[model samples]
Target: MTDEELAISVSGLRKSYRDNQAVAGVDLAVRRGEVFALLGPNGAGKTTTVEILEGFRQRDGGDVSVLGVDPAKAGADWRKRIGIVLQGTGEFDELKVGEVVRHFARFYPNASDPAEVIERVGLSDKANSRTHTLSGGQKRRLDVALGIVNRPELLFLDEPTTGFDPAARREFWDLIRQLSHQGTTILLTTHYLDEAEALADRVGVINRGAMVAVSTPAELGGRHQATARVGWREDGQARFEQTDHPTDAVRRLSERFGGEVPELTVTRPTLEDIYLEMLGEKEEQQ
Candidate 1:
């Protein structure tokens, strides 16, 4: 894609704190109108890299552009074009949900209607409730509401569903898809592999302060080429083998059992499995 087509671009990015290097010669690009998921282990420079992109921290070296402007030198107008939902919830104990959303809506020039934003995030029922009285998942919805209240071109979501239950998480996923469908570019950081698999057009994995790999969820770490595990019960004991052709193995097992294979199953590596392998966590096992 052309430079003008990208919402964010980083080349040879570097950052360090005292004696520790948080980011080292990293590179990344996020296209406009795309959901890009960034995954990494603890202390893998994810936060530092994001802070630099958000203009909350200065970088030591690199050419970084967000919305065609250098974030290191970004101004108030530039900041207004991007929205961020941090990991922590806001402390608005005395304020109603609608009041809080309306207050934040004032910060941007092209802000959306507070009521509509609330409804979009599935927070319409809590619009009149006190912020402190909302449940954990509701608070997260409010956070998303505030983030989109600006009608931002690019939205940054950091651990957006940390406290959500399974059902709530699915609901939030739908909300994210709705936003993306509305032409909003999103940069998502999450520990949930399933969330990344569901929401991201492409995912980038960072390890040891550097980018290790970037690809579609299905192809990362060669997951599509990886072997599948075929398992079945044999003599009251489970037997398994890794094979590229699991269907043939299953057919063989079915014939041997005269119509059915007891406890027969075939499974492939999940996104998390490939992610861990890419990060070299699986190497420790070897």
Candidate 2:
């Protein structure tokens, strides 16, 4: 896509601490108004790369652009267009939720209503409660509230749902959808493969400071083209086979059984399965 279609652009990104290369020649692009997930195991260069994109850390060498400006040199005006929710709680001890949100809103010129933002993050009930009294998931919601109070064009989320329970996670997903509907671009980093599959339009996997792959969650690592495993019970035994045409295989089995195939199952690789396979292959190459 063209530059106008992209919210973030990077090429040959590199960062190092002494002899340890935290990010080694990474390249990434995020399209405008899309939810993109960056996935990797701990110690991978994902954090370094994201920090560089967010302009929180300097890069050793690379061309980096975020929202049409190099983040390294971006001023306050540019920062106003970008929002970031880091990996943990936004600890504002002793302050009530409403007070914290109102304080942050003052930092942005075009801030959203503090009360609306607090309610949007499902913290209206906790608005009067002190920050230190909030639960882990509630704290995360507060972090998100602060991040988006500016009504930023691009939002960066690092493990935004880390402490959330299952229901809370689904709620957060719906909130993300609402933000995307408002034309906000989001870059998310998470260890939860299922969350990535559900929320990301595309996912990029990183390993050993390099990109393993970048594609839509369904098509990543050719997962959409991978063969399906068809299994069935037969003559007091179990049989299974991998086939590109699972429907044809099932039809043949049905004919042999002269009716519905007993205990039949057709399975394809899940996003987690594909992610693990890609990581494993990358390790073998290293």
Candidate 1 error regions (>4 Å) = 281-286
Local distance difference test values of all predictions, in order: 0.91, 0.93
lDDT of 1 by residue, 218-276 (tens): 99999999999999889989999899999988888888889988888889999998887
**How displaced is residue 90 in candidate 1, in Å?**
1.6
In terms of lDDT, model 2 sits at: 0.93
Model 2 Cα lDDT, one tens digit per residue, 1-286: 7899999999999999999998888889999999999999998998888988888898899899999999888889998999999987889999999999999999999999999999999999999999999988889989999999999999999999986899989999999889989999999999999999999999999988988899999999999999999999888899998999999999999999898998999999999999998889888886
Clashing pairs in 2: none
Candidate 2 — number of clashing residue pairs?
0
Q: Measured by TM-score, how close is model 1 to the native structure?
A: 0.96
Error of 1 at 40 (Å): 0.6
Model 2: weakest 10-residue lDDT segment is 277-286
